[model samples]
Target chain A: DARVTQTPRHKVTEMGQEVTMRCQPILGHNTVFWYRQTMMQGLELLAYFRNRAPLDDSGMPKDRFSAEMPDATLATLKIQPSEPRDSAVYFCASGLVRGTGASSYNSPLHFGNGTRLTVT
Target chain B: DQQVKQNSPSLSVQEGRISILNCDYTNSMFDYFLWYKKYPAEGPTFLISISSIKDKNEDGRFTVFLNKSAKHLSLHIVPSQPGDSAVYFCAAIAYNNNDMRFGAGTRLTVKP
Candidate 1:
């Protein structure tokens, strides 16, 4: 079965270092999303893309976080000068959104295993 | 501020009993709702979903109930099994937007 794939299952870095997480969405899926799960915040949507175009990144921290879909198959989430507070399990999800009218809806996302980041 | 909320942090249920997990949303614009199940060290898996047009949807032993007027939704698992123990998250998508908002999740422990 097809599935979203994420790399670097775990990462540990010193505060102020850069952390990068990568995801390969399921084939034929046009939408990609990035989420972070923390003990306090739970699951938070950081950004999303549709057709390789960013739909929104308002949920992400403008100063340190950036998300991009460089190509249909590759999506990335990067945090520069990462801080301990930024540590969390980052998840990548993808879906093929379709439908219209009463039937219109975003398809359920297929999530990757996630990247566990630890900043000390 | 979280638009979707799962107030309960954890739940314990005996095996073979019914397990109910609840979620609430504040946005009336939200017309689609979903339930995701996550195991430790794994990604959340799509369990089931319900559209605004329908109040309920079912897949096998899993059932989802949506109350539009009350802005509430719930997932019910009948004959809960030990393998069913996991963290469950509630997600919502607005009719006008494709962004999906998620709740804090409720960890369910099925005692065998």
Candidate 2:
């Protein structure tokens, strides 16, 4: 079956280090989303892209976090000078919905296994 | 502020019994709701979803109920099995919005 693929299933980094996470969305999917899951905040949407263009990144920390969709198959979330609070599981999800208009009401997301990042 | 909330941190039930998990949302704009099951070290998997137009939706042993007036939703699993034990999350999507909000998960344990 097709699935969203993520790289570096686990990452361990020291504070102030730069961390990069990559995702390859399911083939033919046009929407990609990045999420972070932690015990305290639960699941939070950091950013999302539609048709290789970013629609929103308001949930991400503007100073240190950046998310990019360089191409249809590649999406990346990077944290420069990462902090301990950044430790969490990062998940990438893709859907067939090109937009949230009337025609895409039933579109559902398919998630990747996620990359567990631990910042010390 | 938390738009979606799952107050119960955990729940336990015996096998073959019914398990009920509740979720509440503050945003009336949220017209679509979904439930997801997650295991340790794995991503949350989509289980069931309900739209505000309908009050209830059922698939096999899983049933989801939505109360638009109260801005609440719930999931009920009948005849719970040992394999049903996992973390359950409630998610809400605003109408015509690409963003979806999620609540703190509730862990369920089904005992034999």
Candidate 3:
């Protein structure tokens, strides 16, 4: 079955280290989303891209966190100078929206097993 | 600020009974809502969804209800089974905006 695939199921890094998480969305999916889950905050949307173009990154920390869709099949979320507070499970999800219409936006997302990131 | 909120952190119901999980949102721009089920160490999976224009949607044993005036929605599972126990997340999406927001999930437990 087709599913979104994420690399490095787990990652451990120290302060000031850089961490990169990769995702391969299902073929033909047009949207990719990145989210962070923590005990206190639940699932927080960091960014999303549609048609390989970044649509929203307002939820992300611009100074340290960056998300990019290098191509249709590959999406990446990177963090530099990671901090302890950044420790959380990051999830990558993909969905197909047929058009800009309201009904098409109802498509549900398919998520990949998340990358558990622990910054010490 | 969290636009979506699942007030209850957890819920428990006996098998064969009904389990209801509620969610409330502050943003009126949201035109669609969804419920997702998540097991430990696994990604959240889509469960059910309801459009703002409709009051309810049902599929098999799962049903979703929406109250646009109250900015609230709920998921109901009839004949709750042990296998149905998991974290339920409520999410919302706005028209023309693919930025989906999620609420803190509610852990559901079904006892035999």
Reference-based TM-score of each model: 0.96, 0.97, 0.96
Which of candidates 2 and 3 is the stronger one according to DockQ?
A: 3
DockQ of each: 0.57, 0.61, 0.65
| lDDT of model 2 at position A7 | 91
Could you tell me which 10 consecutive residues in candidate 2 chain A have the lowest summed lDDT? A98-107
lDDT per residue for candidate 2 within B42-78, as digits (tens), equals 8889999988889999999999999899898999999
Q: Model 3 segments beyond 4 Å from truth? A: none
Model 1 docking grade:
medium
Error of 3 at A8 (Å): 0.9
* DockQ for candidate 1: 0.57
By lDDT rank, best first, the candidates go 3, 1, 2
What's the lDDT of the predicted structure labeled candidate 2?
0.90
**What overall lDDT, based on C-alpha atoms, would model 1 receive against the true structure?**
0.91
Candidate 3 shows a clash count of: 0
How well is each residue in A26-107 modelled by candidate 1, as lDDT tens digits?
Answer: 9999889999999767899999898999988999999999998899989999999899999899999998876322244445
Report the error of model 2 at residue B29, Å: 0.7
In the range A20-63, model 3's lDDT, one tens digit per residue, is 99999989999999999987778999999999999889989999
For model 1 chain B, the run of ten residues with the poorest summed lDDT: B92-101
lDDT of residue A8 for candidate 3: 85
Runs in model 1 lying further than 4 Å from the true structure = A99-106
